[model samples]
Target: MDEFERHGIAVVEGRDAAARALRSPELTSDPGLGSPSVLLRDGDGHARVRGVLREIIATLEPFPDAVRADVETVVDALGTSFDLVRDFARPVAGLVTAAVLGVPLDDVFLDHLEATTANLDVFGGTDRQGQASAFRLSVQLSRAPAEPGSGLAALRAAHAAGRLDDDELAINPVVLAHAAYENSLNFLASAGLSLASGVARTSARDLAAEICPARYVLRFGSEGPVAISLTDGLPFGLGRHACPGSGVALAEAEIALRALADVLSGGCRVEDVRWKTHPVFRGLASARVLVSV
Candidate 1:
């Protein structure tokens, strides 16, 4: 998460830090000067994002076909009214982090991770009481045993190797959950809604294939610029603390998109997918959409 704070300099990434720095007389108060400066201040978000991408590509390269097939089957079974944010999107995103960290995909584990981290749009931790409660529960859940060479095990091993300290070990999973869930859910919900409403399904499907799995997400300029141009923006986020798990999130979402496209190729079409109202993040608070495919 600190990695993101360092690297993902998008409006959201270093928001707190920038605000703090601005208070210093050394910095300019003009929002314009502060904007790009915060973005340019190198951070670890990019490196982490790269590492996560590498992990995802490795994990999925061996099982892409099977993963795609499974996603297709599951979506098909759910029978439309498919809430991408809930039914498919966040679960798969969470799974990617779990897979990398060597965590098992148990119901309890997933619930804990989701309850705590799912609502996080920013890769950094949340301040809400519910977020705090979830964080505590998730930490306990992550300490549970799992298969060898799994994501959690790997994280443990990394810590043992001194790659990560105890603090990093304890915090990384929460970081992972936050990284994986935020925009992945938003992308799925946003793209799915666009597809369902006949607003750009094909374009979204194509773009998902091309960009859903990001190489690196960059945040440029100030918040005003970002807010002004939502189109063509990378959902992986921007700046130094943008997202370390962008790759994992992208792979999972792309795979899901592919599955949905193939399954609903002829039979089903999406309709009426709603988005959340909060300005802090993007995702479907709830959506009612039919999946006839």
Candidate 2:
């Protein structure tokens, strides 16, 4: 809130107001984050880039059997005690992200992806490290090789077909990866905390609505910047820029969390629960869950 205040950005609260604000043509996503990225564009540009992304995301629509197996494998490997973020959420989310890009992402790639969260700060004027992380990931993805049916290859194909220009092709893959990873990562970890803390069984959709990991999204309009709350039943966002990967996120969470529930069916203990202070993206920094075998 102080960050927005410092930047003279107004906040729109409550479900109705935020929904109206998100749906308003007068309000638009901020462009300062980067050019040619779907999150930073509106109208034709946004639609074009977003369409490409939507198509890429559709590949995982039914939550591919391969992806489900991968998530289950990770969960099954969980020892008696583990950090949910690292051992569970990170790997599960990371595998899905890798599947999205059709490439293997190392810890370094995940580390940089995590760092890029700081770049999402609308008030990132003084955050050089965050800016550098974003830039590095962009550069890294630019040079990354893509397999035949991969997301990166799809973007390159779109560029080749002239649907996306050079700049859009270069940056949007990273945007797609970040979009696919960040929320799922945070949501999975937080949801795991809820489960470990004895929260009753709930659907993945309910868990998402409850956690609302990406707390707020910023938009610019005639009156200037307005921070819209996603916590108000708008977790996947509300309009043209709504998360295209929402289905994938929900499916991933459902599979992973279900497996986690089985792992903890005998009960568990949650320790050292710590939350990240990112204003826009809310998540746990770390939480250790010791399960009873």
Candidate 3:
């Protein structure tokens, strides 16, 4: 039993059942928190907000050569002995996210975005630090200058065109930034750890299924909060609230992991491996990869 189960939230597992539940009209993404994030609402408003985000994401559909090189650069910079989470995954994920926002994000901002994972609580905001970090990010992104045609810039344009309300404009950029950064960060580090484990190299989608970061997503039903397990291979999820950026995420992972394969090709030994205890978000806390090349 995990935190959600303890809080009387039902755990819907198995690929088939989870898929059905996810697409069911009986379940809703909104937890009644009145959060304006696209991930937290339903109906026309959800569609509208998602449409704006989808357009912004489509701009990077095939991903981009520049970002791909950035990913390779981050991985190639790895030294013989380095922490996979710190040295390999962090920079790679950070670079892609910064590209997504068209704004450079510092380590402190990324750290706060990672901490916002705790704010995904179904039990009505228990983590003070998470909430604080979220507030700080919201403030920062609201004031952050966006470049022309950037994701944030697109979002601002939507607001100007009356496609988004004030609350939606204020929060969704942070939501998008966090969404883009957190899962990729977890996925990259977990996949790096997997490669360092000497497993047979596999496709990014396959590895994404196996590693499954952002393990469970919350939905609401008559009974209350329900945690839908993604271990069933629905990593990007299903139905309306599905990760709109799945295409970008998969492409991003394929490039990063392919570049990572070369880095780990000579074989490696992993040391002091540690995993995060967060039930909903699965990832490595740290793992030292000692390259033998």
**lDDT score, candidate 1, position 53:** 35
TM-score per model over all chains? 0.63, 0.97, 0.97
Q: How do all the candidates rank in terms of lDDT, highest first?
A: 2, 3, 1
After superposition, candidate 1 runs with Cα above 4 Å error = 1-58, 61-66, 106-126, 202-232, 237-242, 266-273, 291-293
Model 1 C-alpha RMSD vs. true structure (Å) is 8.5
Off by over 4 Å in 3: none
What residue pairs are clashing in model 2? none
Backbone clash pairs for candidate 3 read none
Tens-place lDDT per residue, model 2, 83-178, is 999999999999999999989999999998888753266545677776688889888988888899998899889999999998888778778888
When 1 and 2 are scored with lDDT, the better candidate is 2
Go through the candidates in order and give each one's C-alpha lDDT: 0.49, 0.88, 0.87
lDDT of 1 by residue, 1-293 (tens): 23444534333334344333333333322232221111222335324333533453366444456555655666666564566667766666555555555554555555555455332323334546546645675567466785775566666666677655565566555555545555565677666555555554454435543333332222234332222112234433333344444455555666666666655555545545455554344456666666563
Evaluate model 1: give its lDDT: 0.49
When summed lDDT is taken over every stretch of 10 residues in candidate 1, the lowest stretch is 32-41
RMSD in order of candidates: 8.5, 1.4, 1.2
